[model samples]
Target: EAATATATAAAGDDGGGAWRVVGGDASADGGESPTRGDASRLSRAVDVWSLGCVLYGVLDADEHPYGSWFEREVNVINGKRNLDRIKHLPEAHALITALIEEAPTARPSAVEALEHPFFWPDARRLQFIQEVSDRLDKITVDNPMLDSLEGRSSAVFGHRGWQVVLKPSLLEDAGKHRYYRPHSVRDLLRLIRNKRHHYRELAKPLQLELGDNAGAFYRYFAHPSRFPGLLMAVYAFATEYLAHEPLFAGYLGPETARRYAADAKERCASAGASEEDMLAAEEAARAAALLSGDTLQETRREWFPREDAWGDAARFSVSSAAAAREAAGALGSAAGLPPVGGPAGAAAA
Candidate 1:
């Protein structure tokens, strides 16, 4: 056990305090695994607690609020933590409380933490999206009170009173990265899916009532490919937010930011983006990064594969073993492969 140790030197003490990194007399198992109260074992809950502690340090100027290593042991034994000390982020206080909650079952998962409102204003943004999306069907009005300037009519999405849907449905506030970024993809996707089916069936007939904006939304998202504009908007929002987030902000100096920006532009171009769109996104990201503090320093990173490669940004459900086996079996039959238990198929070979 690399981090296991016992405090046998102290009377009434058992296997704990791994920072000591040495087991003591009359101690076994050390503290290599985690324990809470009477229960002791390896667990993701234990890791979540550790993550909370590490985050507590990162957000608090690398200072451990638990005093010393020995002090933390005392706190754990008493089932208490100093989570309230992270006052700089009032929006995150509830999150910090939840992370260090004494009950193991009460703790939230990593994905939950990433999706939490503490990181971004998810509810507000979603509400804003819904409000504007609903208004798209109101039929772009020309303010009948005003004088007619020319033969042109004001239905935005289409040419006539029946058509409000624009050709390239231009969003009103797309450039405002601060207001539009989505902290939670799950939340955004949920809102989009929830609205898609109802609006799809009602789009044409309802465009008579709702107008062209609703028609535009329905037409764009009704397909199997889903709405690329909304998807790209969410992706762009994340990129902009991450670039300017307090933890990562200003960590990339201009030169390094430029290099990263160029790398991103190249990647975007490879992903079938026009050179112009690529440059636009790159510039936006770079500008966002520069808006924060200076003095470049490395930002924190998660361990393992995420450390070596890009973090798994796209969430997906896990595949089951049975599903894998069934698929493989079907593929083998199509390929005319030997069946299982065929004695290595010597004659066929």
Candidate 2:
């Protein structure tokens, strides 16, 4: 059994003092250090909290995440974090919030912390969108994942029409995919599914033409206001998915697959599986995941030319009429229909 110690700090003028660690060795100055077993049990969580504080200080110009020193421990105990200064940085703000969770179990481990969206590159962010879109395609209307996505989407895009946030030319392109009215997040998801399916079916020339405008398309979801939630939602889903289906985790990335595979191997050993059988199972899992293909990676390569392109412009630059005309021409050439502004197109108009 590990001994428990209490540390006390001088009370403020109001007679309040900081909180103390519960399991540690007594110290002369009233500080405490955890004993071996206690350290193993508590250090990771305590370290996460400390790191959160350090991150908050660094990001917010040395401002504490909790309030003043007198009230800091109390605020922390009450789950009151002073995150105002870091709100402008949504990913960092979210990471700090999770890191400083009052429940030790709720705080992410160090490995998970490094995997947070705050550290993701633009390409990974784009891959997240692709994965979410693919997953949305397979889920039913009543799926709980839909509810999660809906709540997040509503927070950012509101319950009203998404057209307000989208460019007219983008909407026009959506119309070409038979998605004329995107009234909600579900509607937006449907539009994405339709467009991606159509993009896959398009001739090389048409695909290239539309792919050139992929940045414009991505802007609707990746806008500054919506991106943080997008990243978080995908992260949440991926975490859940990885836990349940570690075997197919290759869809996320090779590194993630390798990590999950190690865990799976341990589970197999615990279950008393033979080494040969475990190796065979691992090979089969890898083969299945490979056969399924990684839609996100494929979409990322086809759509985004460079990571920098994601942030090069605040808005999609092409005019509505020009974009519509160019897209229509590309589709027309691919499908053997008359070009935009030609006699047949003029007659139809």
Best-fitting candidate, measured by TM-score?
Answer: 2
Error of 1 at 66 (Å): 2.8
lDDT of 2 by residue, 6-72 (tens): 0011111122322233223222233444467744545676777677777777787666777677676
lDDT of 1 by residue, 184-295 (tens): 2232333343444344444354334323454455434322233323422332322232222222223323332332354444443343332343243344333323322221
Error of 2 at 19 (Å): 8.9
Error of 2 at 90 (Å): 2.7
Off by over 4 Å in 2: 1-35, 180-183, 186-220, 225-228, 240-243, 246-349
When summed lDDT is taken over every stretch of 10 residues in candidate 1, the lowest stretch is 1-10
- Off-target runs (Cα >4 Å) in candidate 1 are 1-42, 121-349
Give me the overall lDDT of model 1: 0.36
Candidate 2: worst-modelled 10 consecutive residues by lDDT: 1-10
Task: Give Cα-based local distance difference scores for all models.
Answer: 0.36, 0.51
